[model samples]
Target chain A: MSSKYSNNLIKSADFIQSLERGLSVIQSFSTEHSTLTVSEAAAITNLSRPAIRRIFLTLESLGYLTSDNGRYALTAKVLSLGYAYLSSKNIWEIAHDPMDELVKQTGESTSISVLDHDEIVYVARIHTKRIMTMSLGVGSRLPAFATSMGQVLLAHLPSEELEEYFEQAILSSYTNHTITDKKQLIKQLEQIRKNGWSLAEQQFEEGLSSVAAPITNRNGEVIAAINISTHTGRNSRKEIKEKLIPLLLQTAQKISEDLARSPHPMNL
Target chain B: MSSKYSNNLIKSADFIQSLERGLSVIQSFSTEHSTLTVSEAAAITNLSRPAIRRIFLTLESLGYLTSDNGRYALTAKVLSLGYAYLSSKNIWEIAHDPMDELVKQTGESTSISVLDHDEIVYVARIHTKRIMTMSLGVGSRLPAFATSMGQVLLAHLPSEELEEYFEQAILSSYTNHTITDKKQLIKQLEQIRKNGWSLAEQQFEEGLSSVAAPITNRNGEVIAAINISTHTGRNSRKEIKEKLIPLLLQTAQKISEDLARSPHPMNL
Candidate 1:
């Protein structure tokens, strides 16, 4: 992590290290550490006390961070950054009702995710119930090689990009059912690309199963993936494929059509 | 706006102007301007093209922004910042089911918002249907003095803060029912605080009405407000007050309880 941070610093003469440090300071506040002292932030970001202090002060002045009794925490202004990303895409607006309908039909958690490097970042979601051991939400990420949505997205990437990804990705064994073998994963990706959907049963986590379909743009380029995730104990793999995949596919098509119709296609 | 921007730059010796400018550049990209040229960004931010170009290049290198045929656009990596904010709060996670229940029971749009300066920033939302002229999602901002959630939040502020707000607020007239007079607004706030909830009839937009209640922390200080917004044409103010207020208040109390039970209360 430190090496990558320094690499970014050296990548460009104009790369603002202070900006990076300031964002890191904001990111340091998490569910476990909502409030942090300068020392704590410094420790997390591996920056100097003065550096952290300056960043904290600047953020506080901007109303993105607030200090109370020497402990710094993020304010609602920080949410605006997320809002910018979400509102720009307008995916939530388009996917809202469709996700709700999917959740209602499946009686399971439904989400839409986009590929970010080697991970799938969930952008929109509607939960029927908490079915996963790891809590997931709008911003949660999972390994791209092991999950249904990730595979669906990865399957749609250009061949050269897919090859580049295969070369760089670390296919760690997340569960007993995880496809850690590169060749096997590549084969699955090919099948998913041809079939227009992907399914994973206990690949990333034990007992969690999901079926995902690609959402395309007007040009038919895969822009995002939508999925319905459920527990394996409640429904067998065949049951999910039979019961949920059709609804999931229909919803993805609807979102894709909406995206095509929207005036702001680049935002999606 | 330019004066305020410069004022922040001059506030502290340690204030990172480059950091602020970099973030502003990111925030400049919106649904309307998802992709921006260096000159376009410079025009919006009042910064030089060279400075904007450097920031854009730096952001692209960091994977938060990408250059496509000379136009820079945000990547999914940008969503991580918002994710950091949303994940830290855990409010959406806690409120998801309850908000869904509220939407189901009331058949209206339900949302939770927190006061930010003179605006209310939506943090979590569950929509039954589109009810307003404007489309709203998490991270959307509404005038605090004109919306039911905003009024509920404003009503609970400390007297000194409320006085300061009243003194500084512009009290723009969004609709005929919008509270434009500071004195009248204060009187209404007093009634809302006393009643433990607020109801606004077409205060923000025509044919829109809402009922809101404060969600307090374990310390009994109001941290957020949750509301149910409906079309006034479909339901009368008395009907909303008699039916939705009870459920809205109950949901807010439930969320408040869950927030108090959370390990990290500062984020809420």
Candidate 2:
């Protein structure tokens, strides 16, 4: 394993390096690199072909992966891993109806996502009439400095963690509208924190715009954020701010209330 | 490890037992058992508490899991493992529009699922105004003999695999209407294979009904099944047969056509 994953736990004797290698190998296969040779996995994971082969054999034996023509790819059994997370969270079941209603009311797609380091991971999504050029669905990740949901989540982070995020995150300019400067992004996050919602116009993608509202837990901590996304061609920034933010805020509150009432809220 | 998972591959020297243990440890936390202690995981996986602790530490280090006090639960980062599967399949992307259109046309929820052994795992779903009592969504599993999509998939399975399924699967009658007899199920499968469509009326659950059609690949072989579901209270068998199956078939065909044309149709 590379020093990239080097940390106290990984360095400790109790931490299973094989488990980390296995996960890294699994993650190496992405939308771009859907299928990979053992050599390819070796290159991506910085491990030898023999080591990658053993991991691949183990995963194939476990039904998480399959290989044909010397190219290995993940199987549907791997989905159970994601299910473990989604089902454990139990937020999707409670948030589904309100999100569906939001989609109906707005005639746009809406999703719920939570912050993870420098990115936000979409937990649940309700799609309506959308022809998304950049396909964002459940389990999709976007930079926290660009998307509306990411901004809402970042705005709610504690001071120490937010500082850590800035320290680690690159804040690359994804588009002309992307806030590349840390101070500017932090200031915008402060404004979003005050407003309790955010609107990102062509920040992540040129024609894409979105507005997000924080979904709080019972203790009023922003556990996640919900967003309504529209094409810039279909919606004006002023219109999304004036019309959708209120409804998005209402839906977010409804989901938050449902989550609070839920007897089993998976503490992230 | 249980002899339950005993196979030739597991016995091989090349298989990584730790990787299998880690996956089993992860799978141990499901919707029912959302949170677990080291002792609980040890009991569930038949591993020692020390071993479970090590695995937990490893998973936490990898960000696939988290813990509070002594209780451990999966983290959203685990979603990426499942994303590897979904994104690799590339079917969900092509199936989305057609499945969404099917939901709109039928005024009900629609889903696509693939057969895994005796169960069907949902890969894609589009919900409209669904009040699902059983809570079937992406990555959810249902017994193949009890669900419409399952029957459609079971009907198309190769003879050797079908025989193995019958040998391995516990033919539990989930509901009063569930087909339990192997001979009767085989006969029904034969008919479903001939008919090219299926209507499962309250077999899996009372007051729930669904109709399904197969989605074929480039070879015209059934790769998956798509179904439209509604509450039995809302629709009678005759009405569903007359109204929904044609649309379901059409939707399945459209998705199949799209899958065939798409550069990447994941070979199951």
Predicted model with the maximum lDDT:
2
TM-score of predicted chain B versus true chain B for each candidate? 0.90, 0.91
Candidate 1, lDDT over the whole model: 0.79
User: Which numbered prediction scores highest in TM-score against the true structure?
Assistant: 2
Docking class of 2: acceptable
Model 1 lDDT tens row, B1-268? 1111122443468888888888898899887787788999999899999889888867766767766568877776776776677767777678877887888788887878888888998877665643211124666798999999999988988787787677677899988889899889989999999999999999899988888999988888888899988888777767787888888888988988988887774746
lDDT of 2 by residue, B47-157 (tens): 999999999988887777666687878877888888777676676678878876777777888888887667898877766653321124777888989999999998988
- Clashes per candidate (backbone, < 3 Å): 0, 0
Cα distance off (Å), candidate 1, residue B215: 2.4
Candidate 1 error regions (>4 Å): A1-11, A93-109, A128-136, A233-236, A239-243, A257-262, B1-11, B93-107, B129-135
Q: Give the least accurate 10-residue stretch of model 2 chain B, judged by summed lDDT.
A: B1-10
- Model-by-model lDDT, in order? 0.79, 0.80
Tell me each candidate's TM-score. 0.88, 0.90
